[model samples]
Target chain A: MTLHRIRGGPRLSVDNDRCERFGTCEWEAPGLFELGRDGRLRYRRRVSDEDAERAAAAARCCPMQAIVVRGVPG
Target chain B: MSDGDRIVIAGAGVAGLRAAERLRELGFDGELVLIGDEPRRPYHRPSVSKQLITGAARPVDMTLKSYTELDARWRLGTRATHLDTTQHVVHLPGGEELWYDGLVVATGVVPRHLPGSPRHDPRVRVLRTAEDAAAVRRALAASNKAAVVIGGGLIGCEFAASMRQMGRDVTLVGHARAPLYRFGPRIAASVTELHRQHRAGLAMNTAVRHWISTKETFGLHLTNNQLVVASCVVLAIGSVPAVDWLRGSGLTLDDGVLCEPTLFATGAEDVVVAGDVARWPNLRFDDEPRRVEHWLNAVESGRAAAENLLAGRGQARPFTPLPRAWSSLYEVRLQTIGLPALAEDTVRLADGVTGFVRAGELVGACGWDRPKAMLYWTAELDRRLPAPATTPAPARWSGPEARPAVGTAP
Candidate 1:
């Protein structure tokens, strides 16, 4: 698993092979996920403690369930 | 298990894919064969209209799951030509025959094109498939003229909204006064207002008589003898079950392949149907069988059908599916549940949202960007009703104030 680590926050892992870029994560956490010009999903590897809820929502709501957030800060 | 215990699934759409996954999850280790006429793997249909059309999602991004993730024999681009229910054989073109102990028909629906419609016209497109969506995207990018969309259903309104957002002058034509006639007046009026707010020209209560395609442009003539020229045209009228391949198969076909509550085909013992092609009585809704073409219905029915197929007919329980669907308008996401078709009365909620009532009960509800209300009502409506008992005249609904406050404020 390729972990995209965020500075001073939780680490994120997106199964690129499994992600279909449906952008549900973008709706859940706009700060974390943004669609690229080529219609692919761009996201932060990690997020601050304040954005943990949104990050969790994104991971939960993904139809493909491809987003994985780990090690959230207190 | 014996060689005859192999399971075959037709149509590699959402329903078929879900069934395959479910069978695997249930530890069905038999040989599984999935057949599809489309060259590509199963892709998400909902995003094809919203994200794909708006350039937020690519064709690759629409996949419900990767092809490698599905553990089955995939026969993509191969159409099932015939079925020999007596011999438990499926006939494919080029004389290929597949015999299965259990068969799942998830053949979904195909867009219903108008009579005398020209498929070869470069400027004409239908918004059913990913390829069709991509074609429209390309056409939209290359053209500078107005775009005319026929049939103001969900797809029509969605495309109109997206096209207008893309800065294309859009004119939406529908036979009804509103886009979604089943939602009743209040919700339809809100949708109408949304379209109007986006500056889409409404050609309601009209039909497209004919299409005139020239070398440079396309022209549409309406029922009122009004001619509108456009750079391209999209047809979003409706869809029909893709059941022609089962003609000589001896399977029961009314509007769709008739099935029992367990998703088992009425005429065949080992055959089951799911997705848009299956018309079975939903126990939750009166006993009358209905066909649902929504994405969530496909997933739920597919999983349920797989479970029943594994359990066998005598032990199988009836599949009761909850009706739910969502749509993205110009700026709001409309989530709805229950039988909007059963709606005889309407109640307008706050912020232009609406709910439909039948026999003095809230049979359906829809909201604009109202997730909490949509989710609560969706779950609430999934519970069994009181068997349609006759009651006195239903009081005029004054909106959300009448109902007791519980889960979320609408």
Candidate 2:
């Protein structure tokens, strides 16, 4: 009911439009990416500020570069 | 004309070809010319060790794009002999020349060769290209039972898997304490365990000090004073930068063509060192430039190089790669993420030798006859939970650390 929803765990998230889904992120760090009920990617809802660099790696690895993870206290 | 800028890609391997494909998709309008040393189109290099050797897949499985499909100028079978940065030109082996506005060197790496032996011997084989695949196929087909694989790198393991699938006894020799110490220890331990459980001869802490070769077989002498007899020896020790011709080409060669964090070599402002030819620093792991020999690294480097070529120096970013690679040995699939530096923290995630997460991200992963749990965990933790400000690879990834003796193989 907020302006937007961050529904998954904090570790990672992706913007489908931005995410080409190169799957490198998943290939590198699978713990943060999972198949949701819809079989699309679901990231951890709340990655800490500490997890920023690694979370960004998972996002950057996306060939589509579509991953836009927020809320890392950056 | 739909235009960003032209991208002249050198070395038509996975990296080079992928750069072109991504370039077209990314909407580059200027002329796209792909130059290479090989005669055929770029094909998949990874399968050379896995499928091509076993006769399960043909050399064509490595093909990324067909000639009919690519929209670039394809110089089939042509070799680039010289590059002039002052003129922004590339000289070819066939007395041809090309003037380019932007250059991308995706010349991939070649299989490392024995220091003394003839590179093209019937007894010894190194896999890197489609032609190399042909030679490996012939050698493996003739290898009925035993194959002594020198160097337990990813290529070595995949080749070992192929030989073992043919029911051949495989002795995988590595000079390190575990397999793939280059990838880090946790993943290597898991790999060593998997190979052992799968009944492949896992010879760790062993090195092929030298060899005595006959026309029909190779007598492998180990550093530990052990002798291995096999008709064929597949050397998957490692790769050498394919920059032998780039000598005196004015590029700084430190191991590979050392690139700035921005991926530029020397001489031309438009030229970039990509793929295995360029040693670019990875901030994700070590700050020092490292050259990784894998399909993804090649593509990533090529794409970034081309993008930076069009974007210009003002906006370019350093080329840092996330260490990611995978291998198929029989039914087991092993993949890893992160530059698993020698770590101080490694906690096993599952009892099946699945993996140890460094800083809670899937830094290294491995498995046995079956890697179900490991793959699942790998996908789950591709990013660390509570995403840290800085990754944990340099801090958390532990190595030379003690691991339980984990092989069921005699």
Candidate 3:
């Protein structure tokens, strides 16, 4: 459950156990998260500051609440 | 509005919580109050029928992480008894009345119960709250007899699937010819196959005619003259909008609180509606007002309602969301976008995708275990929808003059 943090921006992590693959995160932050054709979740571990808001929105939109964004700037 | 102004939100579910968050995100510094009938803070309700029943997640895991961050007065375990639109007052039980400059109705829905069902019977249960899920779990653990779930809707199906995963003999009973009939024949067939592969019994197109309870087990006599004996029975029939308290409130109530395209309560400028309790016509589709009881609708409508309330009616934009919902059963993941029930014809597309057509146009699409197909179809459906209306930018406020004078008529 360690919060991953990138040097310049926030980092994203999905709890594989809790993630139900709803694909809602992909809709909110397409570049950061995606639902592959194989029914698996594909996401970047770190995102630039410009994508922080969208990443946070994706985390909030997740029904499972499995997505976590760390080191978000105020 | 200044700090003296207040916005009282009724119902503290996901929609209500989202509305409060949006208000704060828009820099609302006015007094904010949330009234919830449930004693606890908002939690993810979908888990009640799935993970909670299977011992995979607890009640604590279902709570929303953002609720604790909102700085608002929480009035939990209290129901809103009455509404005085003219006075802009919301009356609660025990003669408590609170004044509000704006209101958001997100009371959500309550599960329907079967007639002649014993309320005190521990064997019969309904899955709406965390308490209900815990009770169902205890009942299942206590009995070795088969569990009978009386419904074929998503909730019932999920419950039945969870029970099967728990290695319990389960039977799903419904009046429809097949399970998930609202999703169309292909999905229904797929769901039926899934149930069959899981070795769960299906008693579709039948209903309980008699409820016979004994010291050891309960027997459900169906209309088709079959007896289902079980240690526990769950009623997942359906739910209706929790609008009983709004009967004399002067708000238009059909199946839910009727609202304008902007999510404002009809004839009430200062009030808005959201979540499963909101019945508004989606301008992207047609003029018929309908209630979308999906999870995404709660989030989208909640934010829209809050924004419209802050921007005022003159500058508010229409809440035209493409309805979306998803359900998980066994290894199958079903995702849908738009109103599948409104389609006149359904065509099966490649890679486990289904297209819903109304008036020779693609109005909805559903993916069965095909997330990629769903993504593409969702984009295609979005392209078909009318372009979003161009509304003036929301009126941003700063300092004390962010809103009108408190108690002033709009």
Highest-scoring model, lDDT: 3
Winner on DockQ (1 vs 2): 1
How well is each residue in B1-410 modelled by candidate 3, as lDDT tens digits?
Answer: 22336899999999999998888767676788999999889899989988888988888888886621468999999999998888889999999999998899999999997888875898799989989998988888788999999899999999999989999999999999999998899999999999999999999999999999898899999999999999899999999999998888889999999999888988676899999999998999988899999988998898889888888877788899988888899988889999988899999876688899999998898888887778777888898986467677654434255553222322
| Predicted structure 1: lDDT | 0.76
- DockQ score, prediction 1: 0.07
TM-score of each: 0.80, 0.72, 0.94
Most TM-score-accurate candidate: 3
Which clashing pairs does model 3 show?
A: B1-B402, B1-B403
Minimal lDDT window, size 10, model 1 chain B: B391-400
lDDT of 1 by residue, B250-304 (tens): 7998999999988999988888898999999887777888898877778778877
Give the CAPRI class of candidate 1: incorrect
Best by DockQ: 3
Give the residue spans of candidate 1 off by over 4 A: A1-74, B1-3, B66-69, B349-352, B384-410
Candidate 3 regions exceeding 4 Å error are A1-7, B1-4, B397-400, B403-410
Interface RMSD for candidate number 1? 12.0
A-chain TM-score, model 2: 0.56
Question: Which lDDT tens digits does candidate 1 get at residues A28-74?
Answer: 68778875656567888867767875786566446555787776532
Predicted complex 2: CAPRI docking category: incorrect
